[model samples]
Target: MLGNAEILQAMEQLQDKLFQIAVRVLRKDRTRIQVSYEDHLRIFRLLQEGHKETAAQAMEAHLEFGKRILIH
Candidate 1:
């Protein structure tokens, strides 16, 4: 298991990556893509509102697969 400091560092790095992905997903390949600190805050606010639902859906899908039985 990662130590607390290591986990915090990892989380910070992950946040940076997520911000980049969010920017790309929110503004796909346009001529200008500006993420001011204020804009970043707004994007984070939007994500905070819906991330739980997205995570819950993914967990449900994963659990459903685990619960299924396959026979050959």
Candidate 2:
């Protein structure tokens, strides 16, 4: 079994890769609107409240909003 440190490191690497993929997809939309502090706080709050599904839906909505901003 992997050690705790090893598992944490692996998780961080996976997060980096996922973040890169998100950036690439968003970049293609040519959006200049960046994620704001309020957006982060909102997501964080939902997560802290144990609302994982709601947090994910909020994130998806945020991404969709960014894409729409670029399209218009």
Candidate 3:
């Protein structure tokens, strides 16, 4: 598995974009941090359990949730 730094380096551009959008939303609504953290924890737990398929879906839901927050 790639280290976090290595993974970030590999997807720096998209990560940067997400950072930008996330910052905007986070600044406006701090509660988003906990909500986002919950989503992340769900995904992380799924991965840790060796559930790749479920983890992927959790990740997709997390990203879609972020997208919804940004668009509205």
Model 3 stretches with alpha carbons more than 4 Å out = 1-11
Q: lDDT of all the models against the reference? A: 0.53, 0.74, 0.85
Give the alpha carbon lDDT tens digit for every residue of 1-72 in model 1. Answer: 367998899899999986765455435433323433344455456567877666565555533432341110
lDDT of 3 by residue, 1-72 (tens): 367887677699788977898898787778889998998898899899999999999899877877777787
**Reference-based TM-score of each model:** 0.36, 0.50, 0.70
Least well predicted 10-residue stretch by lDDT in candidate 3: 1-10
TM-score of 1: 0.36
Worst 10 residues of 2 by lDDT: 28-37
- Point to the candidate with the largest lDDT: 3
Residue 30, candidate 3: how far off, in angstroms?
2.5
Better of 2 and 3 by lDDT: 3
Cα-based lDDT at residue 31, candidate 3: 89
Q: How do the candidates rank by lDDT, highest first? A: 3, 2, 1
- Give the Cα error of residue 24 in candidate 2, in Å: 12
What would the per-residue lDDT of candidate 2 be over residues 1-72, giving only the tens digit for each residue? 367898889899999986875666567654432454567689999999999999999998877875565565
